[model samples]
Target: MRLRLSALATRPWLVALLIGLAAQALFAFHLDRPGGIMFDEVHYVPAAKALIELSGPRNIEHPLLGKELIALGMDLLGDNPFGWRLVPSLAGTATVLGVFTFLMVLMRGRMRVAVTGAALAMLNQSLFVQARTAMLDIFLGAFLLWGLVFLLWAMRGTRGQVLWRWCVGAALLGLATAVKWAAAPYIALVALAFVAIRLRDARRAHRPLAAALLSGDQPHWPGLPSLAGLALLGAISISVYFATFTPTFFYLTGATDGLSGLLHLQREMYAAQVQVLPHHNYQSDWWSWPLILRPIWFFYAWDHGAQRGVLLIGNPVIMWGGLVAVLVAYAVSFRGRALRPLALALLWTFSVAIYAIIPKSLGFYYYYHLSAIFLCLVLPVTFDHFDRTRDRGWEEWYVALALVCFGYFYPILSAAPLDGPMAFAHWTWFPGWR
Candidate 1:
């Protein structure tokens, strides 16, 4: 009985992932041709067009890869509304896949947890809205999540497997950095963590420093060879990122300057973002995000002879539940048994939270808190404990409750054209959410 249950639990999460991806794709299709650019798409589309023309200045605020990807869709689709949004829609779907894969790996192939995470992420308002628009957020998120997946794989694998993991991780990090520089620090954080883990294990095992010097020979370190491989991977990723901008930098601008231009651009962009303090209706603080205090309205319209719009907000059920679950995970993880899950929860939580305190005046609800989508996964792990200790039927009850909550609020979240009273009812859940 135990063997059968274990086998069932270990089934691959690919089916759930496909279902989630398909759902997002269907949602994207619904939004295939929004009449006009939604909020940030205004900035992104023109920037992308300029990029395609090779006439636009290099934007230090974001990497070129996402714009480049958008340009591809524009070229193929003739630069219409559908064309502009196609890439983000696809990228968003791909993020669902990446999240599913990450959860599967983290949960040791537990289908239940993996499916729950992917489904919740797919349905997340911020993730869904970003995916349906022509913006860099989904692109940045995709690459970052992919890199994280690779990092998790590397942590679990042996020396021979570590090289491949590092290589893939490097490539993903490069792609992520090319979409948004915000993802760059995570690569360094993971690398430092990896090095620390290996060093500690080496000391624990009492391995001689000389033995550890050998490549891929040490049991824990993967030794010097692994480090060399990681270095090579880093170089390759960085080379790819720089190579993409080389032609334009050298030919168009006659700028033979290396690295200085990138640094200068970053400084300018940072200054531009930090100095702006004009009050806005949708502005929210980092402290309020975990509480789902205020969600940014990405799109709204009432003039099409009827009310219709998309309001991007985190799923209230999942956001609140996951927030609590993360606290529980932290407590349980300190006991050692839940260490891995606790580490991932902390990583996901801290990565976004630290950025929230950056003191940049223009920080928006969407900028840093997007990482919270992953927190939903932590709740399912918490549910697993409930399944073990509580009633065996608790899993079904929990899932049903979550689905019910999602369905109840679906109209407001998806802009399904609720009337004044209906909308007012939804807004009453959190007065500030309005």
Candidate 2:
């Protein structure tokens, strides 16, 4: 048993994962001490409070799971700002772990890529900020990624493995949906992508592939048992989702009445979301996001005496670097040199970009669904190129560049109070950022 445990610990990806989790947890703990609602937390904390009281206004649009989770934190920690934000922080940390594990599975345990990806994700300001706040994005993002991770794991496993993964994926999807309805489209897209890929493979083999594909197999596929296993797993996952919610859904509100009530609530939420007439200073279109044209300022403060302050903004270097990396991945993949990585990057980037163009009524900068996933895709490509070239000097230069960029922007990302002039200096770089 000791030997087995030691062997597991020796895995570089696992070691890196442990370290990443620790770093995230520590950062979250430090940030948790700031005991006041910031930005959207103002909206969500009240919503969660209403949820706990059961007599407050109902948010029919979003599912209760995320709010309920926040309430649980508040219940244990006292309904302070820290209590409300704790769950999302924990979820965000867990997402780093999940991404590591998923990438480990995807790369078949490529230690360098896995470790780099997880590290980059943990350090990302967008993800880090979301994790430290009381919002649905982190919770939903974590679950959605978890579900996809399991699905990917199943795809690469044996019959038993596939079965286990499929069930986990389905259950996760249900939980994801419960957190935010936006995840539903991602889940559907994944399912559709899986089907399309399978069909393509079947056609390439020129065999009667529908039955085999539906069964999760090909004529000469190595893992024949996986077909039936995946089918069963998918079925089990869907069942788990319904099973968990149907009761709360029926009890909290009467079944028939609850269903109707839920629908009514949804309509109200939809109308509120679609109201485009209302104007706000921070409002921005989706196209500008890729260019880092506008960044939502989550928190800011001033201190005349201290002559210092904190401003929460996305790390421009990482954000802009990721954008370029995506483009590079596309260019490389267009040449058919490294198809898989490019395909993953393209799918995630494109999916999020398309959502931006949909003219949705209530889109926010936080609507960057591909946020974490984009980092995941970019890190691997960056590392892969560096590894193949074996250019230590260039790698050092890249690290130095990333560090300098992050360091320069650290004061802004952290909520450290700054004087008005200093704050204006940071704002001067990105005028539209404010």
Candidate 3:
């Protein structure tokens, strides 16, 4: 057993591939369940159909890429439950793989840490429910995560390959924003991080910033192009964002003409998105999201002589335990001056911080999905912090505990038949959840 574990740990790419395939299978299983549109599918799926028919845009408050993907899926798969949800399920699988790759790179191919983090990502309930639904978050999340992955790759790539890697990263970031405006802050963060790193390197090297930009010889951070070059990379993302609106140009009546029309559409979307709305039964404050204080019920129904529902709640084992893991990881990183773990912790913070400053009047638990993923990364570092004694046996047991919790909650997360009509009551552990 020890030999097998050791061998697998040495093959991080294989572990990531296996994890990705398993996630894809799990997400694809029984994806047509509940027999109809459950929650937000009521909004986006129809817009997709509308897009396919050159009908008017129905859900114009958001960008077009997510709906476009849904339309593409339906176009290929014949417009049923399978078609509507295929893209999200695939996106979800990509998210799990992205999480694994991010950890592998960040931790320098620490396979155990990457595997543990990726396992936690699968066990995190929010991803499962969101993946099965036709919502936009998972799509945006996959792009954002892979975008970060490429950014990390750019940092370490050979000089010949760095510029293209950086451009690919920037373009993916733009695709994320094209899916949802929520990705705007992350794009800004990427650009700002590039500028900050270049400026810092210039100061340390005692060279003028312009000289550094022109030389394109960033020591310790090779391959990153000049500031003007990066701005053009940023334009790549903006152009990608603009290109997704091409389908909107074909709309029967409200066809967007060009750059001016796209700008008009964006203003209209901003107004629609920011306008205050009535209270929601499952609406939650940004602070309560990490606590799992309230979870949105994507679907709850009695069908085929059985009762079942899908709840967008995080696995308590991870949600509650991750809070402690983050704090411990923080203390350990700060004490040891570990920059990598600190970076993971900060990424988690910024993911949540986007919500705290957004102009939207109401928020829901699903908004916490991105931050919950970061917790997966943070939890593994916490384990590494304590594994100084070289006993990795505990990590396996921890993953086992998470797996048990996932099994216990599987019926609720996946819309599987429940034991009785009040089965949902058993899963709702708090008043807010009710």
Candidate number achieving the greatest TM-score relative to the actual structure: 3
Each candidate's clash count: 0, 10, 0
Q: Which is better, 1 or 2, measured by lDDT? A: 1
Candidate 3 lDDT, 344-400, residue by residue in tens:
777888898888899999998988888888888888877876783587676778888
lDDT of 2 by residue, 1-434 (tens): 22343466457655755756675665565564344677778778887776666644455456667887888888878788678877888887778777777767776765555655666666666777787788888888889888878877877767556555666787898788777767666666666666666666767877566554555454322254334544554565455444434323434433324657555655665675556766766666776666666667776644323333334455566667777777777777777677656766766676576666554665567777456456665656555764644634443345456667666766666555555654546554767865
User: lDDT of each structure?
Assistant: 0.68, 0.64, 0.85
- Runs of candidate 1 with Cα error greater than 4 angstroms are 1-17, 58-60, 158-160, 208-215, 218-226, 250-264, 303-305, 356-359, 385-396, 420-425
Off by over 4 Å in 2: 1-17, 219-256, 302-312, 357-359, 389-400, 420-424
Give the CA lDDT, 0 to 100, for residue 125 in model 1.
62
At residue 417, give the lDDT of candidate 3. Answer: 92
Q: Give a tens-digit lDDT track for model 1, residues 1-434.
A: 23443565645554755565586665565564346777788878887777667774654466578888888888888677778878887888777777778877777786666666667776566777777778887888888888888877776778668667867888888888877767777777776776666666667878765444344665543533546755865796787666656534633443436688766765766776567678888887777777777777666666335465666677676777777888888888886688655876777677666666565775567874346656756776776654644546544555566667767766655556668534544554667766
When superposed on Cα atoms, how far off is each prediction in RMSD?
Answer: 3.5, 4.4, 1.8
Models sorted by lDDT, best on top: 3, 1, 2
- Tell me the lDDT of candidate 1: 0.68
Error of 1 at 157 (Å): 3.5
